[model samples]
Target: MQDTRATTTVAQSGHATEVHGWLKWLEVVLVTGLFLAAGFWLRPDDPLHVGNTFAWPVLAPLLIGLRYGFFPALMSSLLVLLVAGWHYDKAAATAYPWGWAAGMLACGLLAGEFRDYWERQLRRANAVNEYSLQRLEEFTRNFYLMKVSHDRLEQQLAGSSGSLREALRRLYGELSQTRSEGLNEESAALMLRVLARYGQLQTAAILAVEGNRNIQPKALATVGDYEAVSESDPLIRYAMQERTLVSVQTEFRKHLKKLDTDLLVVIPLISSTDDLVALCVVESIPFFSFQNRTLRLMAILAGHMADMLCQRDQTMAGSHEWQSLCSQARRAARDAEAFGLPSVLLKLQVNEQDLATLADRMTGLLRGLDVIAVNRANESPSVVLLMPLTDELGLAGYLHRLELDIRENAGRSLWDFASQQSLVVKTEAQVAEWLAREGGAID
Candidate 1:
C-alpha cells in the first residue's frame, strides 16, 4: 500500500512538471510573437527611418526574464534582434541596434538572476518558518504532557492517606451511580462550577466538541459583569488547534476582532484518547492571584471535566483504566519512598474464567489508595495490586479477605490463585525491581 502511494505521488509530480514545462514554452512563444507583431506595426515606411520599434522589443525579453528566467529571455532577445536587423538598413542596424540588443540581453540576465535570488530567499524563509512551527508544537505537547503527569502525581498523593482514600472512594461511587448517557451539558455546568470556586473566576464557559470537530459553547457560568464572546472565538480555535492552554493577549484579541471581555485564559480539555473534547474559557479576576501554576491546575480540572463529558454508559473508568492504575502505582511508589511510608506490592495469578467478576471483586476489596493493574505479558494474565502505607499485618489481612471473597463469590478455591507480596522500598529503582520480579515493567 505504501509503495503504491509513493508511485502515485511520483507519477502525479511528473505529470505536473510536464504540464508546467509546456505552459512556460507556450508563454515564451506568445510573448515573442507579440513583440514581433508590434515591431512590424510600428516600422517606418522608409527602411532607413529606424523608428521607436527599436525600443518596443525590450518589453518581451524583460517580461520573459521575470517570469521564465535567463535562457528563455535570451532566446526572445535574439529573435527580436533578428527581426530588427531584417526590417532595417544593414548599416543602421549594425551600429545602434546591436547595442540595443545587447542592452536587452543584459536586462534579461540581470532580472532573471534577481528573480532566482528572490525565490531562493523565499524558500529559505519558508523552511525556517516550518522548522520553528514544528519546534513550537513539540514544546507545547511536552508541556501539556508534563502538566498531566504533575496532576496524576497530585492525585496519587491525595489518595495516600486512609481518610482521603475513603473520600475518593465515595466520590467515585457517587460519580458511577450518577453516570448516564447524554450528560455532556450537565457535566460542563458542573465543571464550570468547580472552576469558578477554585480559581475564583467569576465568568467562564465550556465548549463541547461536536461531530465535525468544532467546539460550541454548551454551558456558561457567570458571577459578575463579563463580556459576551461568541462560540467561534479565536481564542477557542487557537486552544483547539494547539491542544494547549493559551492566555488572552492583545494580538489574540485582535484576531477575535473584539475586546469586550476580561477573558484571561483558554484551557483545552484533552481526553485520555488524546481527543480535544472541550475548551474552558475563564475570565481573570482583578487583584486576584494568578500564575502559571494556577493555569496548570485549571487545565488538570478541565481534563477531568472533559472525561466526564465524553463518558457514555460504560465502566466509569472508561478505556484508560489500566493506564490510570499503572500511573497511580508508579506515583504511589515514588511518594512512599520520599515520605518513608510503608507500602506493599502484591502480584497475583488468577484463573482466566470470570476475570471481569474477579477484577470487580478485587476493586471493591481495595481502598482508593490501592491500585490493581493487569499484566498480560505471560501466557496467562496476572494482576498486580499496589497498596500504599500498608504494613505487613495490613497486607496479610487484606489478602485473607481477598481469598475468602474469591472463593465464595467467584466459586474458586484458594489453589486457583497464586500470589506474592513484597514490602515496597524507597527509590524508583527499587520499585522498578519489584515490577520486574512480577514479570512486567512499570508501564
Candidate 2:
C-alpha cells in the first residue's frame, strides 16, 4: 500500500500527459499510507466509524484522479471499496467504491483516446511534407529542360532570320549588276579582317591540287612567313595519304606545343574525274578554338572555291573545255550540308585528278574554310549536300536554284523529279540515323 501511495503521489506531481516510472512507485506508497491512516484512526465502537468507514476508500478515487489518472484511479477505488465493505459490512460503503472505480475508468479511456488522436495528426502532417518535397523537385527538373529547349529554338530562329536577310541583299544586288562575281577576293578578305577585328581570330588561305604539287597563292603561299613544310612533312603526308583531315593537335603534335601556333585547319578537295586532291590550310590563334560549324563553313567555302576555279579554267579555255567546267560545276552545286554543328564532322567533296593543278586551284579559291579531304563514294557516284533550312519550302527553293545553275552552267540536270525524291528519302534516312547517334531531337 505504501508503494502504491508513493507511486500515485509521484504520478500526480509529474506533467499530466506523461506516464513516469517514479510516479508509479510513488502512487503505490501513497495508497498504502491512506489505508494505514484509516485503519489506525477508526474506532469500531463509534457510530461515526460507519460514515468514516468508507472515507479511505472514497478518498482513494479522488487521489487516483489527482495522481495516477483514470485507469489507475478506477483500480485503486475498487480495491479500497472492497476493503471498506469487508470491514464495515455496509452496502453503502461497497456501492461508493464501485461508483468511484467506474468514474476513474471513464477518465482513463478519454485520456488514451486523445493521445491516439494527436499521434495520428502528427503522422499525417509528416506524410504531406514528404509528398510536397518530391513534387517540388520534379517541377524544378522539368522547368530547366523546358528553359533550355526554348533558348535553343530562339537561337535557331535568329540565325535563320539573319541568313534570309543576307540572301535577300544578294538577290537585290544581282538584279542590278548581273555579272557573276557575288563576293570577290577583296570582299572575302574584308570579311576575314572584320571577323578578326571582332575578336574571332579570322584566318584565310587557298590550295589547288592538280596532280599534287599543292599550291597556295595568296595567304598560304605568301603571308611572307612560310614554314618549309614539303610534301614530306609527316602531317601533310598523313593527311594526303589517309585522304582525311585531322585535327592539328592530333596531327601536328610538335606545332601544338609551340605557344605561338595559332589554330590550323586542313581541308581536302576531290575532282569530278576522281583523280586530284587539294588541301587548304588556315592558321589562327585565339582564346577559344573554332566551333564545328565554323570549321564546316571553312570546308564548304573551299569546295565552292574549287568549283569556281574549275569553272573559270573551262570557261576561259572555251566551249569544248571537255565540257569539263560544266561537269565540275554540276557536281559542286549538288552537295549540301547536314552534319552536326559546333563540334566536329565538317566535310566537303571535290572532283579532280591532276594533283598540281587541283592543288593550285584549291589554294587560290579557298578563303576561310579548310579542305579536309577528296574522296569518291565507294558505293555511289553522287554527291550529297545536306540542305539547310530544309523543310518543303526550303527544298523547293534549293531545287529550283540548283536545277537552273546546273543546266545553265553544264547543259545537264543533276537530278530529275524522281531522282530528287530518292535523294530526299536517302537524306531523311541519314538524318534519322545521325539523330539517333547524337541523341538529338528527331524531326
Candidate 3:
C-alpha cells in the first residue's frame, strides 16, 4: 500500500507517457496535413518555401524532448528535418536538421544527470539505516542467546554443588565441630579455605532478581577483607538510590553484614528491557553507565544467570509460561506465511501503545512492498505483516526495522510472553500461479 505521495509520483510519470503516446502520432499527421494545406493557399512553385515562418521546422525536437525520452526526442528531430525539405532550399534545410539533432542530445544528457543524482542520494540514506538496524538486532540477539544458555548451564551444575556440601559436612564432624559455636567457627574457617583452594575471590555475593533476602556471598573473588551488606544496609540503600555503586568506606564490616563483600563491585542487575532487576554484589569496583557496552556484558552474564535460575525454578515449580509462548510462536509462524495476498507476515511482540503507531509506520516502510493484509489474531499478538514481492530476502531486509524499533523499548518480551511469527509473500504473482498450478494449467 503506497502512500498518496508515492502514488502521485507514479501517476504523474504514467500520465505523461500516456498523453505523449496519443500526441506523438497526432503531431506527425497534423504537421504533414498542415503543410499540404499551406501549399494550396500559397500556391508557389515552393509554396512551403524556406522564408515561410514554419520553414525552420526546428521547434518539433524541443517539444518532443520536453514530453518524452531520448528516443522520441531523436525521432522528432529527424521528423522535423524530413518535413523541412518540402519548405526549405538545399544547403540550409540539410544543415538545420543536424543542428536540431544536436540540441536534442543536450536535453537528453541533462535529464540522465538529474536521474543519477536523485537515485544515489536515495540509496545512501537507505544503506545507513540498514547498517544501524543490523547492529542493533545483532546486539539484541546475542544478549538473548547469552541469557538462554545461562539458564541451561546452571541446571547442569546444580548436582555437583551437593557433593561439595556433603564432603564439607563430613570434615566438620571429624574435627570435633559438634558444638554450635564450634560449627560456626569451622564454617567461617572452611569458607576461607575453600576460597583459597579454588583460587576464587576473597568475597562475592549472589543477588537474585525476584527477591530481597536471597543474597549469599560465596566469595568467588575479592581482593581484600570480605564483608557482605544486608539488603537494607546503608551502602546498598545509597547505591540503589544512585542507580550506581557508591563504593563507600572499605571498612564496611563494622557498618554492614558480617559476610565478606569489602572489595565490592556493586553491579546493578538489568533485564533485557533495561530495567534493573537486582544487584549482583561482588567484590570489585563499580564502573560505567548502565547503558555502556561493558555494563551490557555484565548485564548479559547476570541475565544468563537469572535465566538459568528461572529455568530451574520453573522446572522444579512446574511452570508452563515459557512453553506456552513457544507453542504460540510455532503455530503463528505456520499460519502467517502465505496468508491472504502475497505478503510478508511480520510477527512482532509490541507494547499495546506501539501497536497502533507501528501500523502507521509500516504503511510507509512497506510502500514498495505488496502488502495487502495484517492479521493480529493469529496466535502472535503482533500483526502478521503481508508483503507481495519477488524477493523475500530483500523485502525482509528493507523492513527488518519493524522488529528493531520494538527492541529499544520493547514493552514486553514477545518470545517470553507471546508465541508469534510473521511472513512476507507475493500477491497476484502467488495467487494466480497457485491457481494455475493446481487446476487448468495442468490440463
Among the numbered candidates, top lDDT falls to 1
* Residue-wise C-alpha lDDT for candidate 3, range 95-174, written one tens digit per residue: 44454445545654444344445445655866898999999999999999999899877874452222322333333233
* Global lDDT scores for all candidate models: 0.61, 0.42, 0.41
User: Which runs of model 3 end up more than 4 angstroms from their true locations?
Assistant: 1-204, 207-210, 213-233, 239-264, 268-279, 285-292, 312-443
- TM-score of each prediction: 0.39, 0.41, 0.23
lDDT of 1 at 30: 89
Report the C-alpha displacement of residue 361, candidate 3, in angstroms: 29
Clashes of each: 0, 78, 33
Of candidates 3 and 1, the better by lDDT? 1
Tens-digit per-residue lDDT, 5-79, candidate 1: 111111232241222555666777889788778655665453222454446567787887776566667777777
Candidate 3 steric clashes:
33
TM-score of 2: 0.41
- Candidate 2, 335-361: lDDT as tens digits: 332232211121222333332333343
